[model samples]
Target: MRAASEILAVWHAFDDFPMETLTKAWHYRSGNEPKQRSVELMRLHRERYGSSGNCFDLALWLIDAFRREGISAYAVGHDLLTPNAHVAVAALDGRGRAYLCDLGDQWIEPILIDAGSGDFTEEPLAGFVSGARVALSVRDSWLHVVYLRPNGKRSEQTYDLRPIAPDALLAAGEYSQRLLRKPLVERRIYTETEVLHWELGDDASYLSGKRGRTEEEPMRSLADRVERIHRHTGMDRQVIEQALTVYGTASIQFD
Candidate 1:
């Protein structure tokens, strides 16, 4: 297994990276290029315009980072039957111990899961600790995750531990970005430190911090909306501009 320190370092590096869900409509309208490799995705993130993608893109990027550091890492995802099929990174340390490293979910650090470990709950990530519990369990050969909210609420997801080849992972991401009906994408939901929801032809709603304090701002011009989103998300201004442009022209509607 790799050193825990190394895993923690990688987690810190990307802990605050923005996570965005762009609809296929936005993707096609922006004329954005298709994703094929982790390196390509990283380059897009580093560009003057920032990059935003689904969980697959985020997980692949983290897996790539671990590989670059000589740690054994792979992309893991659940099958379609799961409630919210998701992707994350499974990294093996030098000692062959595996840990779950999830950046797309904004985890504070890597979670340790011993082989055949049964269900359990752990404290929230460092910066996000609010007496909430992150529970992990194995069921139906898939990793089940539940984020227990402080208010007795729970958000759930699952990931298949079977390692997905890089090529296959890329294909899956492309397919999701192209053909999948992603409600988050449809609603133009994006979150980093806060949750942002914006729908075409409607006012934008922003939930600042974990307290869920929400504020609604009237939709000004598309340019104004882009600026507002960039300000709150700290995403690349250019990327937000392009995405908003696509949002406007695509005439995307919510279900």
Candidate 2:
């Protein structure tokens, strides 16, 4: 079991790691590389790029990280067999509570997923998805999350709280590691007023926050886009360059 404060200490460190966009390309040697690398590699790429992998990668990394500290941890996911599947980590805080640590979604901090605990709060928690007051609840074997945005709109999702087996987690991770859709990169920027989400891809990019979303023109030159991505994501220039080269450019998207 782990302590919430202990998990926070670990997450405080991981909070600096960016959610990477180039893992799939790096694994396939699709970028400006010579040959395909091992598809199962995660740690090497994390350090090589100075960031963490996507959702699955982040979950797996956190699980191992908690274990290294002698804490119990596991992976939980929903829609695992679908293209929209998402995964996150669940670590037991020895006190019989579990915290939902979702760095992939750029959560500012982990939130208590155990609603039965005396410390649980129904008040919406901010930063679980950045710029939103995320309300969490556990009932009927499911964890429900509601995102209250600054704008007059809200979105909801249900997370199956059951811990998934290691083999299933690995299988889903490998499948995701091999699937390359676009050169997508994400980063959460903190400011005195609010948190802004920067979402970038080969075809499109945007900075979203309390005021509103500002869509940037599609970057035509690969060099320019790579530089811009680096400025936002803190990924190495060479890595971003290679990833864009493999992903190529696409028509600008409006959505």
Candidate 3:
């Protein structure tokens, strides 16, 4: 339990780090290596742009951090064929208990996946998500998660706990970086009572929590949107402008 708690503590530190593609969109530099970016590059991006890449990038960052802290962590994922596939870290504690650490989808914190852990319980865990309760069950080698959200809506995902080969992971990361969708971002902001998701996307932006959701005021112009994104995300003005400009051009091309 102590080991899992330590992993959880590391996961909590990233609540403020956004999982977005803007930084990579603008600061891209092609190379021979696979798309798993170095933590140093991510640091430079955060310092200069205040934004980061998608799930693959975030997973890489977290795994590297765990290793530096002397923790045994590895990358895992599912939906390997989809561009929208997910990636996350499976960190093992001193006793080899594995905890699922997901920051890309921006989970509130890490959760214990090993049912064999000392403190593992059957009760659904709340607070890890807003407006929902998370239930974990392990079948064979996979950890299955079910989110019971409002209106009886049930969402499910399974993590293939088997460790991914570094080369394969990097190849997938490279493939993921090639694709960019709408100019968007999602971040988690937690309060004493609930977790709030701040989302900015193609059509509308809003803040959603357990109680309700509030729409963000629309930006008046391109420059206005850049300023607002910077204010809300603390990304550098220059970086935001450059990245958004690429998306704007892509929109024009597609249109």
The TM-score leader among the candidates is 3
- Candidate 1 per-residue lDDT, tens place, 1-255, comes to 123788777766674465566433455554667833356745655564555456776787787788888988988876522335567788876667678876556554577654453423343442332224576666655776677664668687777888888777777766655533332321223355543323222455544335633566665676776666666556666666665555555544432
Superposed by TM-score, candidate 3 places the C-alpha of residue 74 at a distance from the truth, in angstroms, of 0.5
The residue pairs in collision within model 2 are none
Candidate with more favorable, higher lDDT: 1 or 2: 2
List runs of model 2 lying over 4 Å from the truth. Answer: 1-3, 30-41, 192-194, 216-218, 249-255
Please give the lDDT score for candidate 3.
Answer: 0.76
lDDT of 1: 0.58
The predicted structure with the larger TM-score, 1 or 3, is 3
Task: Please name the candidate that would achieve the greatest lDDT relative to the true structure.
Answer: 3
Model 2 lDDT tens row, 63-180: 8888888778888869885667788888888676888888777777778888787788777866566667887777877888898887868898888999999878877776676666
**Shift of residue 229 alpha carbon in model 3, Å:** 2.1
The runs of at least 3 residues in candidate 1 whose Cα sits more than 4 Å from the true structure, single-residue gaps closed, are: 1-3, 22-27, 30-38, 80-85, 115-131, 179-203, 208-221, 251-255
Q: Candidate 3: misplaced stretches above 4 Å?
A: 1-3, 29-36, 251-255
lDDT of 3 by residue, 41-157 (tens): 887867766777788889988998888889999988797646657889989988887878888877877777888766876578777765677988887888788988766778988
- Rank the models by lDDT, top first: 3, 2, 1
